[model samples]
Every structure is written in structure tokens, then in C-alpha cells.
Target: MRYHFLSLVQIFLLTVTTPVWAAEQIVLNYKVFRESLSVEEISRFAQTGELSSSLKINFALARQNPKAVRQYLTQPVKVNPVFLDRVLNTPLGNVILDQISQVIHTPSQKADRQALRAALVLSARQDSQITLIEIFKNYPTSEVEVDGDRLESAYRQLRRLQTNIENLMGV
Candidate 1:
């Protein structure tokens, strides 16, 4: 049964490594349309505020203001990784993650909460701050699907989370 044992080992390796794929493309989903862009392109725009033709077209079609989008992309929320992890493990944190997951998720729409929590913690651990772009950069998927129509709501949700944390910490 050597052949059977080898097959089982291969299957185990693939299953264990499946979720390690980092996001390469982001798909913005609007009610009537969608557009895909590379993570590099978005990062460049966020850093330099320079729009590639594809981004220009996407923004124009989506009727989004480049400056506002840039601001949202780069806004940083300071966090303590240990505290963040503790908070995220709570029931309230799970509820927040569930709400945010509806706006940002993997292409298959599976493990959304787990992925988002991983991304957030990873981003915060890397730096003391988390940004929208940082979260997307750390997402554990080949493709990230974002609800373009609900971006503002997601931002508000994040802000509320920050406010709640601040209040709890008396900061």
C-alpha cells in the first residue's frame, strides 16, 4: 500500500497549503458592473496618488472620487496586536467581522470571517497601524472580492470598532 500512502501524503500537503495563497487581484463589484485590478496597481496609486488608465476607467465607471478613494485606502488606524487579537476573539468581534465580511471576501465566498481576521491581525502585527490597503495586501486568497457599493458602510463599521476599542481602553 505504498502508493496509497503516497497519495494520502500529497493530498494532505495540498490541503494544508491551500489557504497560503496571497491576494494578487482585487475585484470591485458594483451593482451593475465589476472591475479587476492588480494589488500592485492599487498600492502604487495609494502611494503616489497616480492613477493608471485601468484605475481611471474603473473609477470613472464607478463614479468614485480619486482623492476620496486614495484617502480611504491610506487612512491608518493604530492598534496593538495583542489587544487586537484579544478583541477579535470576542463575540462582539466576531459579529463585527461577520458584517465586514459581507463587504470584503474571497472569490469563493468561503472562510470570509477567518480570512478577514487573519488579514487584520497580520497587518497590525507587521506595523502598529492598519490600513485598508494593508488588509487587502495581507488577504489570504488569490482574488479578493469587494462590494464597491458598500465600501462606505465598511469604513463606518471599522470606525465604529475603533471607537468602541478606544472607549473601552479610555483612550
Candidate 2:
């Protein structure tokens, strides 16, 4: 009986903890990608006449030569709530999709939030949706409906994309 009880306890713990761990990893990936990108052009133009910052300037110079911008966009930067109900079910899903899309897009690529949101809405995979929903839950909010049916959709293409970013972060 004791052995059976221990086994049951272990199974319960694993089942409970697995979701939390998975949720945390998804959130981390979302954060790494979000922090890596910024609206620097707006800030730079506000501060200086140049539309781009020194980073962009350097990137251009490097492009003239041959080096990756990974060194610039990614840096040794040291890195929420419980709204994990239904992310896209509410209006917040649209916001979440846009942010993830922005992360997926090339830094220099000209894309608007709406376009990114639309793309992800159309092509996002399961894991990507799960990751986005996990990231969205950390946001503060009011009463929101949870829609399990819709979030089931997946941006399978993003499966590799998220993995690649997490791998890049070495996290």
C-alpha cells in the first residue's frame, strides 16, 4: 500500500509540474525574442536626425563586409501573471500573435503589427500557439473567456523557429 501510495504521489507530482515547466520554457522563449527586438528607429530618430542607431549603422557597415548581426541584436542581457486561461480567445490573442510574429520577422524587414498578426493567425503551428498562449497568460487582465477549441490550431512552421531562438539563447 505504501509503495502504491508513493507511486501515485510521484505520478501526480510529475503531471502537475510538467505543465508548469513547459509553460515557463515557452515564456522564456517569448521573452528572449521580444527583448532582442526593439523600435530603435523611432527612438533614434527622436534623439538624432539619423533614422537608424549606431547598431544599425554598424550592421550596414558589416553587411558591406561579411558578418552576422547576431552580435548586435543579442547581448549578454540578464532577463509575470496567471491569465493562462485562453490567450487568443480574448482580444489579447491578437496582441500575442502580433508580438510573436514581430519576434519571428527579420529585424530589418518592413512589416506592420497587423500584417504579422494576420500571418501568424493564418500559418501558426500548435507549439507556437502554445508558446504564445503561455506568454500571454502573464499579462494583467480582467474577466476573459477561455476558448480551448481555437488555440488548438498550430503554426507548425514556428515549431522550429521557437526551438532555434531558445537554442540561440542557450537557455
Candidate 3:
């Protein structure tokens, strides 16, 4: 009877703690193909004033890179660039960027930036609709709904592209 009671306690403990342990084990493993971005690249990109085309392509590539990294990490991970950008553009972004900059200047933050950029891209590619919803929830209430909606639509489109890629890879 004592052995049976002890076994029941052990099972109960495992059931209670397993989920918490599992949740903490879920870490965001970030990787970057383009690990470095120079001031020259930023300045040139900015100066060229091809913001629309450049952002479009960069955003697309960012989506692709993260999935590859996630597969390498062997975990179910999602990357959303829109969420990343929105987060970065917020006070949270400022704090993170500031810390990163203090450790290294903007140009030097290339690795961190690339890692985060890739993560966001991957999230968008994986599940953009859910990502956008999450981003919208995090967004400051002061933001215009129309702007948020537009961004959401963009994320959805990106998600569709990501789905196509997954289908091609048979992942």
C-alpha cells in the first residue's frame, strides 16, 4: 500500500511539473545567414530611397532564413518580421536596441540585429495570421486601427508565401 501511494504521488508530481518544464524548454533559437550589416549598407539602402522595393525583398528573405534556422534547431518555431519591427519600433525595441548599442554600436549590433531579423522573418513565414494578432495585441492602443489592419494584411500575405515554401520543402 505504501509503495502504491508513493507511485501515485510521483505520477501527480510529474504531471504537475512536466508542462512547466516543457514551457521553459521552449527557447527561441535564432540564426542568421546575413549576420552582418554595415553602416555603408544601411546608408546606401537609405540613400537609394528604394525603401519600398528593398523592404519588400528584405522582408521576404528574412522570412525564408528563419525557417531554415528553425529546422536546424529542430524545434517548432515561428518568426514574424512585422512583430519584430513593431516591437523594435516601440519602447521595448528602444530598450533592447539601446542595450545592444551600448555593448556595441549600431553597426556592431549586426549580429543581434540579424538574429532578431531572421527570427521575425521566420515567424511571419510560419504563422503570420497568428503573429499579426499577437502583434496587434501588443501594439499601443494609441495606434490607428487602419494602419494596424494594413500591417496585418501584409503579414497574412507573408504567411501565405511561407506556406508555399514549406510545401515546396515538404516540411
Candidate 4:
């Protein structure tokens, strides 16, 4: 009886400690080429500005600047989670989310819209700010796939959305 109680307690503790879901790998898809990178590698680069060997090689193959990638990963766009949530629920926000989802989505391409919405809201709720890395980290999936060629376009879309939102708020 005592052993059964201890086993139950251990099970509860493990459940509480584990993350329900989070992106473990990022698959960058460019044309017909695809490369996978671990979330830890990206997060470390964002925090320390140091790229792993695999990342460096991938950047070279993709013709992407590590510095620029790091910049976007770390740049924080301040937002109010409540307001963000409201906007994201609107028609216009749905359009924007749909566009962004094309660039960043699940490996199976299922629930892309919903996953993007959750990632955006959770990222903002974490620090009242959203960064590309934060969104990637919060994505509720085991693997997140990105259209590497359309990455710049996606970033532009996000910036445009943020600007419009701020203008409307008179901020």
C-alpha cells in the first residue's frame, strides 16, 4: 500500500515537470533541400551569438547570414497579450496568421493555424514581447518546419502587422 502511494506521487511529479509539447527540431525547407537543426542549437546561438558547426554549414548552404538570423531571433517586439489575443481572433488577424503559418508550421502540415496562434500568444505572455526564437520555442509541436526561402517575406509580414497594430493603438 505504501509502495503504491509512492509510485503515484512519482508519476504525478513527472507529469507536472514535463513540457506538454514543444518544438524539438526545426526543419528548414528551401526548394527541394531540407536541413534539420535542434531547438537547443538555435536557442544557444540566439543567447550567445555563437553558431554550432552544423548551423554554420546550414547557413552557408542556405546563403543566410548568421548575424541577420541572430538579429531576428533576438529582436523583441513588445505586445500586450490580451490585446494580441483579441486581434489574433479577428478576421484580419486570421489572414495574417494564415500567411505566417505558411512559413512556419508543423511537420505534418496539420493544425498549422492553431499552432501558430498558440505560439504567438504564449511567446507574448512569457515576457510581453515576442521574438522569432520565442515563437519557435513555444510552438506546440515535436517538429516545426519552415519555408526557408520565404523566411524574409514572413519577417516582413510580421513587421508590417506590428507597425499597423502600433499605429492603431497610437503607440
Candidate 5:
């Protein structure tokens, strides 16, 4: 009877431990890309330097916009224009930045460089709106403080960036 009780305790322990182990695996999967690198490699290439310049910029933008990230992650991956706009605008747009940074390198092949730059610009523009919406959602009171002149200037800059990206992508 004691042996039977001990076996039950062991089974209970294993069941409790199993989820912790599974969670660790999930975390590992998320961080695996970093693990493959040697310390020397990381040191030689500054984290930002390791990524393409465009990707670095995109990361900055994404860091600034978290809502987009949440929306993108939660949404289905269909190509709905409205959904696309939201995803692009949210911090989730940072995914494009992440992809570009992962692949971008100095002395990159010409084809790769061109493709990355085009993607960076497009993602930034589309995502910017989502980010702005998120900001508004979070801080509705800030709308009352809007300076018309500043708002116009910001909008112009955003439009210019979007146009430049479209031109580069020929889209």
C-alpha cells in the first residue's frame, strides 16, 4: 500500500512537471535563432549592425507600435485589405523588420538588398497607420492637444515615405 501511494505521488509530480517542461520548449523555440550564434559572432556584429539598415529602422518603428503586433499575431493570415492595413499599422508590422534584419548583410547580393529595401519601406508605411491608430486608442485625451501644423507636417513626411517605397517596389 505504501508503494502504491508513492507511485501515485510520482505520477502526480510528473504531471505537474510536464507542463513546465513544455513551456520551456516553447520559449526555446522562440529564442533558438539567437542560440545558434557564437559569442564571438555576436560581439563582432553589434546586434543592430548584424541586421540590414532598413531592418534596423523597421525595428525602431515596430518597437514604437505595439498594438500592431498584438493585432497581427491574433488575426488570421488572410489577405484582406482592411486586416492587412491593421496588421501593417500595428507593432506586428515589426515582423517584416525582423525578417529583413535576419537576412540583411553588408555586401549583400544585389537582388537580396533590393528586395529587402523595398519590403522595409512598404511595411513601414502600411504599419505606421496601425501604430497611429493604436496610439490614439490608448490615449484618446491626446487628440485635444493636437497641433494642426505639426500634424500636417507629420502626415506629409509619412506620405513621402510611402511614395518613395512604392516607387522602389514598383508596386
Candidate 6:
């Protein structure tokens, strides 16, 4: 009986103390472009090593008009939708989407725009409303390794997709 109890205790300890292995992760690097890194700023910085004088104020009021904003948003953008779907299914992608949904604690905008933004953010594909280019700027871009078991092909493709994402960041 004593030996049985000791064996049980040892088994319990082993089960309790064993380190659990985490899920597999797929790594990917990407850059997001939002308001701060406007094209004008990029152009000026490229040519003169500094942002334009107008950008110095960086006030919303001084920025482009509604028409210009619309025009800019109307420009064509490109992305890989299939790749995006695979990413959105991943842990890191899910987290990103969750944060975005959290920020939208309350809904105010049109239904179409809201849905499109959510789709574009995860889909990594171009839509009518916005693109990654419009979401981040001069911000730190990093490779993502999502937590969860995934097929080898998924990880392999993600690494391949990273090149295009990195190129976009450079643009």
C-alpha cells in the first residue's frame, strides 16, 4: 500500500511538473503604412533627407482636404488574399484581428467600410476601402510566428510571402 501511494505521488508530480510544449509558429515579417508616413513626407525625405516644411506642423487641420483623402484612398493597391486567409487563421493573425475588433468597441461607420477594413487587415489583399499601406507608417515591421500547429506548407508559403510584404514596406 505504501509503495502504491508513493507511485501515485510520483506520477502526480511528473504530470504536474512536466513542461508543456507550445504550439508551432509560422514566421512572417510585414510593414503597415498609416497616416504619419504620408507619401509627401516619403518623397521629401527621399529627395531632401527631411520632411516638407508643411509636414512640420503635422496638424490634422493642415493636412489634405476630404477630396484629396478620397482620391488617395481610391488608388489601386495589391495583396495576396489566399495568403491572407491562411494568416488570418493563425494565432498571430487572430490576435491582430482581435485587437482591431477591440478598438472598434462601438460601431459608427458604414457597414461596408467596416467590413472591408476587417477583411483587408487579415486578408492581406487589396480591397476597395483600404490596404496595409494605409494602416501603418515608419512603424517597426516584424516577422510573425503564429502559435499553433500548422502544416509545413503553410509555414513555407508564409516565408515566401514575407518577401513581397517586405518590399511593400520599402516602397
Indicate which candidate wins on TM-score: 1
TM-score for every candidate vs. truth?
0.85, 0.20, 0.21, 0.84, 0.21, 0.27
Q: Give lDDT per model, in order.
A: 0.84, 0.31, 0.35, 0.83, 0.31, 0.35
Q: Residue 6, candidate 2: how far off, in angstroms?
A: 10
User: Residue-wise lDDT of candidate 2 within 5-82, one digit each (tens)?
Assistant: 458889875543333211111111121121121233322332343434544543344332112222111211111011
Q: Which stretches of candidate 6 lie over 4 Å from their true place?
A: 1-64, 98-118, 121-171
Tens-digit per-residue lDDT, 1-171, candidate 5? 355355888987554333211101000011112112222222223322354343344335434232332233122221223333443445544444233323331222234333333333333333434221222222212111112113223333334444444544456
Better of 3 and 4 by lDDT: 4
Per-residue CA lDDT of model 3 for 1-171, tens digit only, reads 355355888987554333221111111111332332222332333345333443345446555342332222222224344554555556655554344323222222344443333333433444542333222222222121212112333344434544544554466
Tell me how many clashing residue pairs each candidate has: 0, 7, 8, 0, 9, 7
Residue 86 of model 3, lDDT score: 58
Instruction: After superposing candidate 5 on the true structure, give the runs of residues whose Cα lies further than 4 Å from its correct spot.
Output: 1-131, 135-148
Per-residue lDDT tens digits for candidate 4, residues 54-116, read 888788888889888788778887877777788888898899899999999998888898889
Off by over 4 Å in 1: 1-19
Per-residue lDDT over 1-171 for candidate 6, one digit per residue giving the tens place of the 0 to 100 score = 355345888886554333122112112111221223343443334345454554443323344343333333233345455545555566755554444433221123223223423435432433422322233221122111211122222333334445444454463
Model 6 TM-score, all chains together:
0.27
Q: How far does residue 125 in candidate 6 sit from its true spot (Å)?
A: 7.6
Each prediction's RMSD over C-alphas, in Å, is 5.5, 17.5, 18.0, 4.8, 18.8, 19.3
Q: What is the lDDT of candidate 1?
A: 0.84
Candidate 1 local Cα displacement, residue 21, angstroms: 2.7
Error of 4 at 37 (Å): 1.2
State how far residue 14 of model 2 sits from its true place (Å).
Answer: 3.3
Q: Identify the superior model by TM-score, candidate 1 or candidate 4.
A: 1
Over 71-163, each residue of candidate 1 has an lDDT whose tens digit, in order, gives 877888787777778888899889989999999899988899899988888888877778888878889888899887787777777777777
In candidate 1 the C-alpha lDDT for residue 128 amounts to: 70
Clashes of 5: 9
